[model samples]
Target: MKGQSRRRVLQAGAFAAVSGAAAGMTGGRATAAASATRPTSIPSARKSGGALPFLEGAFTPATKELTAFDLDVTGKIPRDLDGRYLRTGPNALGLEDPRAHHWMLGDGMVHGVRLRAGRAEWYRNRWVRSSQVAEKLRETYPGSAPADDFACNTHIIGYKGRILALQEGGPLPYELDGNLSTLRPYDFRSTLKSSFTAHTKYDPAADELHAVTYYPTWDHVRHLVMDHTGRLARTHRIPVADAPMMHDFALTGKYVVIVDVPLTFDEQAAQAGALVPYEWNHHHPMRLGVMPRTGGTVRWFAIDPVYFSHTLNAYDDGNRIVVEYTSMPAPFYAAGLGSGGPTATGAPTLDRWTIDLTRSHVTATRLDDLPQEFPRINEHLTTRRHRYGYTASAAEMWRAYETVDGQIPDTKFTNCLVKHDMLRSTRQVRRFPAGAGASEPVFVPRRGARDEDDGYVLSYVNDPDRGATDLVILAAQDFTGHALARVHLPGRVPLGFHGSWVHDA
Candidate 1:
């Protein structure tokens, strides 16, 4: 049965690559140390004891709190009575207030849902008719719209008591007014098309609010300052030469940092031994660019990025600006063989870098040596004041690349989280149990709570043997190895792409 299942998966993967679904489909693992790889199968329900074994001497808060819920949304395709298609799942919603009660916005896809603090009751109805946006998109993209409800790709942000949302494909700002039940939707699509990523930032010196734009395809960043009334105040067009085709960015008080991942079709084609068309090779770049928030000229530099930085993804921590990355070089196999050939070979590297803005210098460091066991870092998990926290993933994972000679294939990979100290250049590392998936850990810090240790670290561990993903909530302060709570997810939360924290009331 195992052998038969492995063959079926390999066939599906080959078909998927030909259909161009390779990029969107994630979370595939090697079936066995010797067998080939396949898309991970979701497991049935199971329970966990809530103990994370590796968080030793990491966080020592006064209390361990489950202030907010780490909701997971896995996409399920279902057919309607008329045999139409539909998608259902939870998305990453941005919180608008200090209170954990309301969620200001919803992503409306597998991981796109969000809400305003204290507004849990708002999602009871679909006030913003997704049908309307669907019509607009159908007219624009033609043939791309599928019948049934589609994802809006919305984002919620908070600034000076005001809440706003940037829908997925456009740059229109809607006045949320802390109400999702009767949301006052305005037609602001004329301002911009295809809003890849959005954030509400404040300029203290000017006492102004800024709504930023992330262009994922073309690799550009734009800023539009708006008054309290939601009126556009000023527009700044910032051009980037080496921004990642992936469109990830960060913002500080005085500067905006743009990062570009260097995954290009040309490189893939070169490795695949085929000639890829020019249209597919446009956005690839291998560099990072720094620009002043006020917008004059931009300065670009090259860096081999391994993973993305946590919240603010890029930030200035007093002395230096640190951009954390997971380092994995393009293996010779991928470059030599392409999609139809053998798998990539070699170990991966996960490390962080401190870029000195003042002197235009950079320093790289490894995160494997900290005192704590697990360090959590991603686009969403960052210290409130950008202090010390954990960094995960960005490390390397290896798998069986190919079968050679008359000998069996030998494969090895490492999955560990690090507790990194930004100020002192130190980190602690912890390895997960055997046969667990390499997923980032979610750290929820306690705010305004009596017991400082009352925070919980939420993570999903995919047990390949059992074919299930377990949700483990551990005491944040008990990084020295303690268990607080554990539960089983109803289904697998397809390895998350990113996460964030919404503090409590």
Candidate 2:
């Protein structure tokens, strides 16, 4: 049955490849655009945050699901690579009215590509059967075994043996099978009772997952710890000044850092019928609370107002803690504000915050002026300082990929990947062609790797020119030159959030 499913996916791809009408049907351009002029400005939605243009263009959800087997390999796939690369993003199953949309409110879908023994095994995309997706499919919201608030659209990972599909402000996770099939809601076997993060840090040394979870509807942020066995080991409340939508948090050797930014759930925005109710509240105090891993008192330090979707890494520096992330100069927009534009300039600079434990203050520094986001690092050196960080190049650097309907796309997009060297303050980048867009670069340490960065960095690139996707592998030692391998997919995979490389062993 799995083989049949894979064959079906490949057949669909072959049809799309050979059919001349597929360009119009799938929104693939007959020829690459001569130029792309995506606007940088957005509007403020007074009411009914309608029709985020970002969602329509490059972010459009597919009309059908697919499963393709034995994808073609363009280069030699290292035999050492043995795993599934799974990425999650909003893939709307149905949007009755495009005007009533937020980029974050779309239905959830996951795309997976497996590789083993130097073979591009298979490719599959599955929509998480959330209430919204279930309704679109005319199916019930599955069994009532373990209820959850699961968008399941942001990130996916393998925890112990369970593949957890995650979202922010959602307490429970939906577990998926090795083939990207949804199982059911998993709340640590119903031991958890609070919202969790899409970004959970797994400590390589401790062999535990640590998360500073926050519920948008609640006031307190909680620190959660799960053992290597995938059991909920501990949970404690981390005091916070406000209940901001904590998309991602920071991890250090001894602490879990919680950021309280200006993006808050707005009652007025909700009453105004905005699909995404969070807004930038300039008056709200921007602070960082450092809580011990053992769950003690939280030390709060006020900092300049800022917003960021991801952090590269954090580490302890004597009495001071250095946290590195990508932050912009203004209050970042939560969603496209009714097409007028986002809340601030979307450009992101590599920002560093040094939190002084003894002085009770934070020294803010702008390490790099480049526009970058989705900063990632070698996960093995997550808590401790490593030399390199990786990020998706901001959309402004690339021509926007057209959507199926060719409607919208003037928002955040990625076309290149970057690697930052912390010690020398240097950066190396790999820029995809004009019509190619890249996702977040996830670093996987090579088997029996010795150095912190002795590994490979992997990501998916959607090349509009080819109307397909590629799983590109880059040698960590070489930074970014040419891809070590490019496993070509038969169909397009939309831009997505976080993903994980699940080892088969």
Give the per-residue lDDT digits (tens) of candidate 1, residues 45-151.
Answer: 11122211111011000010011123332321111101101111112122122121101112232211122221211111122224333342242332332222223
Q: Candidate 2 local accuracy as lDDT?
A: 0.67
**Residues 1-505, model 2: lDDT tens digits:** 1333222211111000000000101323222221121211222222334434344445555556666667777768888889999888765555554555454555578878888999888877788876656655666776663334445777788888789988656536788999887778888866676666678899989998987766544668788899877778998886565557676788899888888877776655555555555677888898898988888888888887877657889999998899998776655655443452243444567889899899898999888775566788888788998798888763622222122132444544445788888999988877776556677788988889888778898888765667777788889888766678887766676656678899995
Where does the lowest 10-residue lDDT sum fall in candidate 2? 13-22
Pairs that clash in candidate 2: 9-67, 42-340, 42-341, 43-340, 43-341, 57-408
TM-scores, in order shown? 0.52, 0.85
- In terms of lDDT, which candidate is strongest? 2
Candidates in order have lDDT scores of 0.35, 0.67
Q: Which consecutive 10 residues in model 1 have the weakest lDDT in total?
A: 14-23
* TM-score computed on alpha carbons, candidate 2: 0.85
